[model samples]
Target: MSFRQGAPWPIPPTATGKVQMKNGYHQVKYTWPAAGWRYEARWHERTPWARLITYPSWRLDRTRPGKGYGPDAAPRLTETWVGDHWLPVSRLRYAAARYNHGCATSTDIELLKAAHPAAKQKKLPGK
Candidate 1:
């Protein structure tokens, strides 16, 4: 999905932000000086059962100077909503993929399929 240039929330004075609304969530990103880059996906709407079991937001913060460095050099902090609390994530990409797939509505899947009819449907992690 293509991202728009701004976010719904107030961006910090020093940070630049962008947002993409897809599947039932708002995928937001912010880049600043020392903090590096931050990514988050917040649910826009949820079903009754989903509200009971899943957290409304998930985040990934990639520290500056650590982007090209190995995992040990930079801290790639990630958090996932698990019911009542945020759970720390060790596997960053996997956690983000899981959030994307889990938050995708049936309509979103159908739209993707329609747009890429010839492409193979790859199952997302934890799907």
Candidate 2:
């Protein structure tokens, strides 16, 4: 899709950016240079908001057993947008995973899968 300069992108409050493609249905361009993270969320108008971005991110719940940290804790699973697929990026506790690039709920994962059926499934390092 072509980019339409100055057009507003449909970015959730958690994200920040404007659309860079005019021919695209719905695209959200996000970039955090200092954080070394850049990704895009594209969805059709009929799709739900949660499924807009076909990416799986670490469930953002701080109340989890270990909050995704410490030893013997739950795995830290985040999403990576690879072309038309969203692949899971898992980091075991004590594995030094970044939380900012993660989701906060399982519902988001389900929704993302619905949007991108070809998404890659990944398990924790040893789980």
Candidate 3:
């Protein structure tokens, strides 16, 4: 549950890096194999190779329609302080009520419970 000293952190591979199923996370290498050396590069950050840092390292095909994500779409990050690295959370094809941080957000007014107060606290309307 903690970072191992002396041992290097598990740096995820950018899109243009090679791939292979190791432990649980995908592994990446900077260079490709010379011939039939076994390892092969899969996904990279963006098209071509520019050696630039990108967020939320992508793998071969592990990504799914996890919330906020689908096949071949941009990834959604959860934790903060990862401006440079977008740590993937999960995928969400669709949501019933998603919290919005923008002014363009809206919600179902019908789901509102106590437009009025009850005895002690307002009772939510039964679905």
Candidate 4:
């Protein structure tokens, strides 16, 4: 767990714990990294958007199946959760556009669930 006392508007997923925003508010966040899925949750002093977020393997990687490329060239899952919606984000540009929009990646859903109980119910859109 990390702390950003006076960070900018968009906080990086890597920074966890209590984040001090410019608006004089604190956002509590937790992230989990996994091999097949990633889960994250963030909440603030005031009402916030969907506090629960999740990502699947396909959305995590940009490399089209059979197309092996450098790590930087590969498409990565969006770390930020900008809106209230869950997953099934199809637009490549949409996912790429949001910077610092997600939390840490987690390989263990069970561990993630411990932090954010709601995570269990917020499954991958179609699954």
Winning model by lDDT? 1
Q: Give TM per candidate.
A: 0.31, 0.23, 0.14, 0.29
Candidate 1 residues 12-127, lDDT tens each?
Answer: 56566555565654444555544453544332222234422243332323333335475667555554333334445444334434547687555544432222112111211233
Give the best candidate by TM-score: 1
How many clashing residue pairs appear in each of the predictions shown?
0, 4, 12, 13
Can you write out model 3's per-residue Cα lDDT over 39-125, one digit (the tens) per residue? 222222222331222221322122222245457564433321122332222221111123222222232221111111111111112
Clashing pairs in 1: none
lDDT tens per residue, model 2, 19-121: 4333423333443322423434432222233433434222211111224666756644455442344445332221222222463355444444443433122
34-84, model 4: which lDDT tens digit per residue?
444454445444323333333211111111223247664544444332232
Candidate 2 achieves a global lDDT of: 0.34
State the TM-score for model 1.
Answer: 0.31
Ranking by TM-score: 1, 4, 2, 3
Q: Please tell me which model should have the higher lDDT, number 1 or number 2.
A: 1
